[model samples]
Target: MAEFDVVVLGGGPAGVHAALAAASAGLNVALFDENASAGGQVYRAPLEGMRAASNADQQAGDVLRRELTASTVTTFFAHSVWAVTGDYRIDATGPNGPVHCTARALIVASGTTERVVPFEGWTTPGVIGLAAATILLKSQGVLPGRSTLVAGCGPLLAAVAAKTLEGGGKVEAIADLAGTADWARTLPAMLARPGLLRQGVDWWRTINRARTPRYGRHTIIRVEPADERLRATLAPCDAAGRPISGQRTTVLADCIAVGHGLTPATEITRLLRAKHRYSRAAGGWIAVADQDGRTSRPLLYVAGDGAGIAGAAAAATHGALAGLACALDLGAANPVRLTRGIGPARSAHRHAARFGHAMANLIALRPGHVESITPETIVCRCEDVTRAEIEAACDAGARDINQLKAWTRCGMGPCQGRTCGDVAGELLMRRMGTASRETVGSFSARTPLRPVTVEALTGNFTYDEIPIPKAAPL
Candidate 1:
């Protein structure tokens, strides 16, 4: 029943900045976040009862929180927004109960999801994603494990390795998909944002000083629980990430954190039916938007990794730009202020994005990676669906993800295709001999977008008032 001029989805750097900019322009704004605090993964706030540390990233987040507190923006922290309607009816399960809001314009800065390719033990108990390990280390002050093997691509490999070392964990080794030469190429792009680049360099140096055996151009081909620990097979990878038949070494570690960069969470954009294009190497399906973040839909905007896989710096600037652009479009901004802010924000955005975009491009899923999935390897963890099932679905004439889900139950999990959709679609595309993911279109996002309890949704509505959905036609 509440209404506002703008409602921002996400509490990351992008959402925070967008709300700040929009509120500064004299528009009513409300920000919703899944966290108890404003910071997202990168600048995640430590859990309550943990001592707050003073660092550059933490300092930046502190400044943002202070600004948010002082602003007129209504904040909805720890809200699980399950559904956003076409008419901008926002439904969320808040701390107390059901909450609803509407807005004239909406900005989705919902950030990214870790991209995972199926392997032998991806679904095993202790094998976690970089995102999980990040929360363990950054937010909870807990070591991922006594001995952890960090396996993945992009900047997070170095960052997590460094953080694990800082948290007093033994880094068994780092199995990185990209070689040193690849990072050398990415270095020039990162140089544009010296502050962020310096942080990356520090991470690299920490792991290097620790003498962690960084297996360059290598991948964790297999993993299995050994005793109370885990044993992983690290194999050299070809340029396309296919396992080379040469030497492969086994490392025993208590924990394994693995992921291949991030995929922009495009569920909102796709659900809104905005113009989108497929670029697997860049990102999967990104909403088509101008430089200022205005999407094909006039009332909708995308910022941060939701639009594309940019880092926090780019996300913040891009958010500022989106908020200001939205203000200008809505005739809410002061002409003088908009003119002053837009140019600097745009330039800074481009500068920071170069580094982030390069990192994102480096982690692009190679052709051989998905092809190497063993038949028994589970692709969808939620449903225990295997690669063999996906292939069988393809054999039985499943043309797209939706059809594949229907045939093999691949994307019909609690995550709602967030984790396995990309890998599943990639497998289907290879079978169909198509390079474009658009060929085997993405899963249609079902509403009540995430899992919600019946009690939370039903509220005081009577049985007759409770809407029942029609069954799908056979």
Candidate 2:
């Protein structure tokens, strides 16, 4: 068991900044990350030697790595927090056994979970997520497929298509859900961060150079596996983002990479019972917090994409501000040490968030996309609950996710509803229009955030040998 002045949950840009700031303020800080190294998805550390790919991300990640290494913060890599008990006690599984930590303040920068809309053949082998494709290209030094058809909303469509081209993979087509008009609307705000905008423009140029057909306001209707290849059917979407039934085109590719932006990974926020509200543009129900990421829960802050759908730059500043907030609120440091730090970080965040918000709006989930789900489409892959079954539950008066789980067993699988919860809730929300989204709340999260075997849970005493946690000080 260990205790600290602050404990940060995640090693992404936000969490790293938070821990560094808090420790810099003369506070004992502990940071935990699920990956073997620090850096979450956006600034994820590339394989040593390979360096995987390039961009501002590479430079930013390097600087972050150097600073974190120089900081006094105690770092725990490959540590997954399974639960938060009491005010700010962390229960996690580390290298050997259970890691117990109590802190005066806790910063949750768990980041975002990639949101993928369900389709007829989403479960097919060759179909991957736009986010996952980047992981393959950036960290694994491998391509998604020989010929990948990239489909989705937001800037990732162009970025992934371009990266695939860079990795020597053929890009058959780029299917974007946002039309030209929609992108035009975001231009003003996206221009707030000219560097990122320039990066995006470069990606588009690369895509065009490869002669990849780009379809605007288009979405993947479905993908059918044909021998060793995939036949992806796409159609132009209406104003609401629903596919126009009759205008379908098929693109042949060995793989399909599709995604619908990202949602705040709210398992920790929900477990801690922070206030939540629905903001479609911010990627569904998010934990409500101040600019410094202070939540309803006392001394608990949420930063980065976990608070909302802000990009990596905004997340970093937001996290540092949260750390400074902890120092101020918890009396962990002198006011003089933090006064200068807070204002500059806040201004930087506001500037970066302008571009981030524009991107969020671009990838916002549209009602028509969720409504377009066919009756046969599986809503919960873990439990195989079809859209029809979920709708039937809604028709039978199941409003909240808990009620749906009770009646239809939609969230009863091993996942306990992480992947399917938001999409399932969106289905339920449509049934109760004008009603508060909070009324149709998400699935209640319990301990052990991720699935664990019984042996791991019970210290493996009953089945095999394993280490056990030493009793804490009485």
Candidate 3:
């Protein structure tokens, strides 16, 4: 069993900064990432022999990668931590083989994934998540399709549209659930970070230059196969995302890239039994943590998107704070080291969080949107569970998400409810007339958190002879 002073999960901006901070403070740290490389989804590295467009954001990721390599932190790439137990013990499978590790303190910075709300024909071959499209374009230098329609909420819509155009892919249209009024309302909070505002302006300018048709307060209600193309039905929506009785439009698209912002990847956090609360603005259920990233569990911390939906800037700041706090807690560093520069980092985090909150509010999914799900629409693609099936389970007296799971197997798929849990919970909430979605409860996390083949587990198994106890005297 390998051990370290600190174990940081994930290799994104947050984990990188945390490892650097702790290592520089004279603490041995091990950083584990599932990817073959360090960069997370946002700042993912391009494939070999493929040159990605140079930018400040990518440059920052490069700098972090270099610093991590130069630091004393031990990095394990292609390592997926499937289970954690007994204080901070971790079971993972790395490129070489299975690894067992323990740490005095643990920092989770696992980041976020696209929050998907299923629509009719969403399981069609041409449909993909906005994050998937971004990865395909940026990392693999592959276009999602020749002509695509980018739909859904949040800043990612515009970002994906702009990236598609830059990659020389024709964008049929860009549909946003938020209208002009939404952006106007969020302007004050967005102004907290002038750079982010400027970046938004730049993305808008790019889309404008492409002359792509941009729709506001609109959503793709359904999609159908039309030969090799996809026919998407678009309709106007109100503030609550309820469809309005207005003229609808249809577009022929080769691909549909859609997403409803992001939700924190909280499987590991939930498995750890850390306290959490539901906050739509924070991207659903998130680990309850303080400014220093300390969670309810002692010596266990969370930072980055795993803690909440704050973007990379805030994630890095929180990571630094958490690292300092961990070092101080372990007596590995002086108290002055923990206090130094923390004030500025916290202030910066606040500014970034303000902008993140503003963006989240603008793109938050309304209840009506979930109500719009058709009975036939597939909610859990992995399990082939439809809205009708879930509704039937609820009608059969399944009161909460866990009961509904046993009744219909909606969240018992390979994705482990990552794709369908939120939507299912909302459906259950509506059926039970729960005051809040949280009342329906989140899916209880169990190990192994990720899929692990039996072959791997058995291959790593070792047999040890045990002394048989003599029969106890009666």
Candidate 4:
């Protein structure tokens, strides 16, 4: 068993900042991440020789990396935390044999996951989420294809398109759902943050330069595959996400990127029984945390996008604040100095959060977002379960989320049902009479959550044949 004063459960921006700040305050800290590296999805390493060409993204990432590496915090990459018992117990699997670690205080910054809205033919091999496509490019420096259609409902779609083109992929077009009407409603909020508005303009200018068509009020209705590639049908939609007339068009591409948006990464915190609130504007249910980032649990705290759908700047700021809070709770710091030093970070967080709210509202999922899904669609890719199977589970008296999962195995697959949990719940709720909150339970996360190479798990193998105690003694 290993012990620490603080143990952070993720290596993303929030977790990194939390670990570093806590350590700087004179606490022994360890950061555990399930990935092979620290950057998580946003700061993912760009392909071999290609770095993140964007000046803003790169600078932000560099500062974070520096702060983390400079601190006394020890980081454990490729280690998965399976379960947590009480306020301190964490069962993690790593190079060590099912290592058990206990910390006086725990910080959860697991971040968010992609929110996929299923549609007909969505499970076709060529269809992927905006974040998943970004992961592929950032991790391997490879594009899904030469010609790609970026169709999604958030700023991430724009960022992904830019990154795709930068990596030598040809972007066919970008069909965005943020129409002028929606922007008009969002204008007041956008004007509140001039700096963020400027950032938005810069991204638009880059998109314009690439000649990528940015359509507003549009939705993808159908995606057909030809010769093992994808062809998508798009049309204009009103604010309610309904199809408008006379705007139907078909686009040809090898791959399509689509997503509703993101939800807070709250699995670890949910296990701790932290309170959660459903804010459609905040991308869905998120942990209900206090201003200082403290959760309901005395020794447990949460920050960043995991607590809510905030951006990188907001995440870093909250992370720093939480780290300070953790330090104070552990009796490791002088009250006055910690309080004074936290002001600037707090200001940054407020500024970033204001813009984050605006962005979140602007990209809220449309009312009829699930219109594209058909009965034959595969909602849970890991389990190969179709929409029909989910409905059957609901019809068979699996009224609650857990019951549905138990009956149909909707979320009982290898991906831990992350891919299908929400959608399955939504379907289950529609079929049954349960409330949405009651129908959607947390995804099951086990140790070694991500698949690692067999060699990595067996590399330390040593065969020592222990001889049976000789019966000669008997």
Candidate 5:
């Protein structure tokens, strides 16, 4: 029964800004996030041994952390949001037990998930997504291997390469489809905004200084294992699908970091019955919201990567606007000034949309990416389901994500379906000719979002109301 003026779910950039903006307006606020600490994927924490190796410019979360702590918002770390009820009732697991809390307005800042591409030998020991490698470096300060090949398209590959070099790991080369010509075309878009352009220039300088070979117009045709390590064969393909042997090369590395791009985290928003649309520029299906981050549901709002795969900066801008809009909806302050926050937020969204569109198109993977999937490759690591089982289920008419999960148990594991749900859904969609819009389903959520000990749930420590004390300066 804990209550507050606003409850922002997620501790990343969007949630951080949304909470601060609302608290600055003198409204009681509570921010809940699953991670023990703040900082989402982009501003991941430096692991024990990797602190000194992290990229400085990309670490914007460091600056925002201080601001959130000083604000009037109370933070609930390691808290999972199980479900959102009418009028923003949130059920969470605390040290005590399963507790239900309420908020006058709710803002969702849940972020993005990696778009995992399945291929031969992907389930090997050292293979991981580009983002997962970065996470390991940020969270545990460990690299998957001494030498790694970064294959996939997007700015994240470059970012990961920069991190690998910083962490004393060797990046053999970056293989991407976007060649010099395509990158040159995107240059004007980058240069149009000085701030963005500078960020790009600084990143390019790091790539140049590292002396890591970058292969534009290159793709990984196949990956093989040798002596328990990975050997990737990459080649430049012509328009007619012929390999350019002169440009073809083989790389022997300890690991391969690969991913197409990121998809929006839209499960929570969908749970709230928000309208969504397929936005090619935004990566995939995203919640349809207004200029101020107002979703179809009046009491609900979404910002950051949850709304779409816009980066952290855009997430922050949308967060500010959503916070202001939520306050106005709840009758907290002057609506006029709050409405003004939309102008800059809208402009930033446009800029982000353009960049996201270009990147999505450039790195778009072929539908046959999953063709190499075999019966032995694990599809759901938590549940131990195999790719063959999923294919069998699809052949049996389990075309939708829900049906596939029920029939093959692909997403029934302890992690629910958060990590592997979309991948399964996409695979089914590709095979059965089912469209993505209808395949999206609500995540199978249970009560007490966070896992609490049995002793705590039975105790008298359930927090029914959020304790909002005297206001603090934001």
Candidate 6:
């Protein structure tokens, strides 16, 4: 296997920054990203022959990509890391073929995935996640539909609405689960970072200019097919997100884009056996890491949304700190030189983290929302497992998420619970009367963390090279 001083997983803001920092310190760094490009989801680059609507972010990503290319770091784009062993060996499938590499130090910056809670008619053809819609617009320069209803619990709802308008898609309405009071409560924290506040204002201005109907403290109660369109029932929700009895509104649109913020992408970290803690504000279970991104596992670190959902700025800062720390540990750079950059990065991360916390509070998912799930609503779209099925399993004494999985096969699918784990855990927790989500626990990470083709796995090796060990003496 090829070896490196450091290997960084992911190509998002954090991964790129970490690779750059470590390489600049004269460490042989190898960075592997699943995407064809370096920018993570937040700063995803537009596809070839397409231009992104947000020039600033695109330009910023471009600058980082340029710097990464110029650095000594070896980049492997379009590479999916499937398994990472305890010995720091990584097995991945790249554009060419299988890649096996080992590193003395490892950094995981795998980023975040959308947190989707299912509702009635969510499986309908027109429904999509907010992140999916954003990717469609930003990367491919395509709208989800001609007319769309955007509903969610976070700032992404507003941002997607703005992007939809900018991309020439008609936004029927924008519904936010957080009320005006929620925004007011987060004012002080929001003010701590003027740039983030300005970005929010900018999205607001776009929606305002388009005169889109805006609903606060509202959520989609149900949706039904209406000819070629979808009819979504909206209801005013209480602080806990339980729908109010008397208030209801209906929206007609070609499509619905919805999500409840993001959760840390923790499969890799979990597989590595890092300590984790549940933080609702930090976007579910996250790796326990210091400000410098050093995890409980020695010589292993996690940064970006994989550590917590602290947005792009904080992710970059955290990545820098992790890289510097790695450099210090590897003796590639002196303590004074490496330590100098960490203080400012740590401060920036603190400010960004505060903003992230405020935003998380404003858009927090409540237990009431979980209570609202109908028996028929599909909880695990990958496996077609319904709420009723999960409840039945729980009633049958499936105490933990793993038990639920074995009983109902809820999380056994291609997505591997990336889309349904949180909601499923919530359901199991409520049924089992579990005091905390941590008690329910997350799905166990297994080999081939992501889907891989059989051909890719076996085509690279001959039968003799399969490494079948001889039987031990009885």
Which lDDT value does model 3 have at 2? 91
Model 6 lDDT per residue over 343-364, tens place:
8878877877887777767655
TM-score of each: 0.95, 0.95, 0.95, 0.89, 0.84, 0.95
Model 1: lowest-lDDT 10 consecutive positions: 457-466
Clashes within 3 Å, all models in order: 0, 0, 0, 0, 4, 0
Candidate 3 global TM-score: 0.95
* lDDT by residue (tens digit), candidate 1, 1-474: 999999999999999999999999999999999899998888898888998666678888888888999999999999998998888889999778889999999999999889878799878889999889988888888888999999988888887899899878999999999987898998788777788878887887888889998899999889998999999999999878889888988999999999887888888888888898877655677899999899999789999988888789899999999999888877885768887899999999988888888988888878888888889899999899898888888988999889999888887888989999888889999888887788899888888788899888766666888679999999
- Candidate 2 residues lying further than 4 Å off, grouped into runs, are 433-435, 457-474
How large is the C-alpha RMSD of every model relative to the true structure? 4.2, 3.4, 3.1, 3.0, 7.1, 3.0
The true-versus-predicted C-alpha distance at residue 334 of model 6, in Å, is: 1.9
For candidate 6, the 10 contiguous residues with the lowest summed lDDT are 48-57
Clashing pairs in 3: none
Compared with the true structure, all predictions reach lDDT values of 0.88, 0.87, 0.86, 0.77, 0.74, 0.88
Look at candidate 1 and tell me the lDDT of residue 391: 85
Order of the predicted models by lDDT, top scorer first = 1, 6, 2, 3, 4, 5
The window of 10 residues in a row where model 4 has the poorest summed lDDT is: 443-452
- The reply for model 6, stretches above 4 Å from the true place, is 459-474
lDDT of 4 by residue, 194-305 (tens): 7666867776777788888777878887888877668898988777666778668788899998887787777777767777776677776677777768888887999888
Error of 2 at 43 (Å): 0.6
lDDT of 3 by residue, 277-342 (tens): 888878888988889899999899998888878787788888888888788888885668567757
